[model samples]
Target: MSNLLAKLISMKYKGKSNIKEYIMEISNLASKMKTLKLELGEDLLMHLVLISLPAHFRQFKVSYNTQKDKWSLYELISHCVQEEERLWRDISESTHLSSTSQNKKRKKTKGAAEGSFQQKKPKKDEEFTCCFCKKSGHMKKECPKYATWRVKKGLLVEPTAK
Candidate 1:
């Protein structure tokens, strides 16, 4: 999937880059994995996406869909498309086996009615930013990204935020 994502990202849509820029670009892959829910770590993500480029492209959404009961990425997408087509066709009978599935479809027919459950809600977590580094991980005041070469007045500043 990481390889596929790289192919997608690099599909001539991302413009251009160089060696140093690519290195720094690779460093932020961890955040990309977390945000994209790719279920991959930083180093491996970079290796697959950056290094493994063309060869693994076909692994993007290959096989996996067993009638014995199993699903793969491609299978899942095909199943979704089939279900959508069925809905579009307005089938009188459902193609799925689940009884609960029929119940939901019935409810969508209007005025069938249903009950909702009440439950305790968890408290939200507080979000914080670094004061020293003025960044998320480190403090704003101590941010290394803010450092400048040949310091002055025991202080340094970054020319640009990016």
Candidate 2:
């Protein structure tokens, strides 16, 4: 009997199991204690259930404490189940948002890398011709010979040390 009472007192809801199941398990222990002539009040059992919940239920616990109306065992179970669903929904939404943002970032980086490669490869149909040197495979602005001619002609400024 003492062992049962100690077990009931020490029981904790670690969130590994379903909230309903955990609550029922605690109620079952309380029932067993009642059969042993160690009856625990409904209010006391409610407090025990709240105390057993994990840290994530801190807000729920606080809300329950601050409210004037008290909850029965069944009401407590219902509210806890709702709170658990809310918590799970919040977590899933945040996970989805993070993954979506990460995917967008990856696509942007991939597009930039592919764009750089595309820019480096010239189109087959467009043959570059240097207007100044009359040379194929090169443009006038990119022609080394044209640049030297411009430097000699004083059209292009030679870089000077600041």
Candidate 3:
């Protein structure tokens, strides 16, 4: 019986487990202890349950503690069940909101990429004629003779377009 109580004290709540199921397990253990000629107080059992809750319920614990009226086991269970529902609802809503926002962002990014593509200027290449030499395949700034002259004049040479 002491071992069972020790186990109950050591048990901790996990977020992945159903909260109601966890409470049922506690009730079963307490009942077993009772059948063994040991009686556990309601307040002590409630406190034990509270202490065993996961860290995610820290805020709930704070709120519960701040309440003036001492709650019975049934009252605590009702509040906990309500809290569990609230927790799951918040999780589902946040997931849906995030997915919607992510899809919007992806569409915006795709549209921006397409817009930039259309705005891109034609590539400068061999198709262009050099203004200086009247020859094909280059620009005015890319004339070899002009570049040599600039170098001789101690002026920096402008790079030719490939």
Model 1 weakest 10-residue run by lDDT: 57-66
lDDT of candidate 2 at residue 63, scale 0 to 100:
100
Indicate the worst ten consecutive residues by lDDT in candidate 2: 113-122
Tens digits of per-residue lDDT for model 3, 53-115: 987788889998998988988888888998988988999999999999999999889989889
lDDT of 2 by residue, 10-107 (tens): 99888788999999999999999999998999999999999988899999999999999999999999999999999999999999999999999999
**Regions of candidate 3 where Cα sits further than 4 Å from its true position:** 116-162
lDDT of 1 at 109: 58
lDDT per model vs. reference:
0.44, 0.91, 0.85
Clash pairs, model 1 backbone: 131-140, 132-139, 132-140, 132-141, 132-142, 133-139, 133-140, 133-141, 134-139, 134-140
* Full-model lDDT, candidate 1: 0.44
lDDT of 3: 0.85
TM-score of each: 0.20, 0.66, 0.67
lDDT of candidate 1 over 35-107, digit per residue (tens): 7776554435433333323332233323221234455423443553454444435433444445668777776
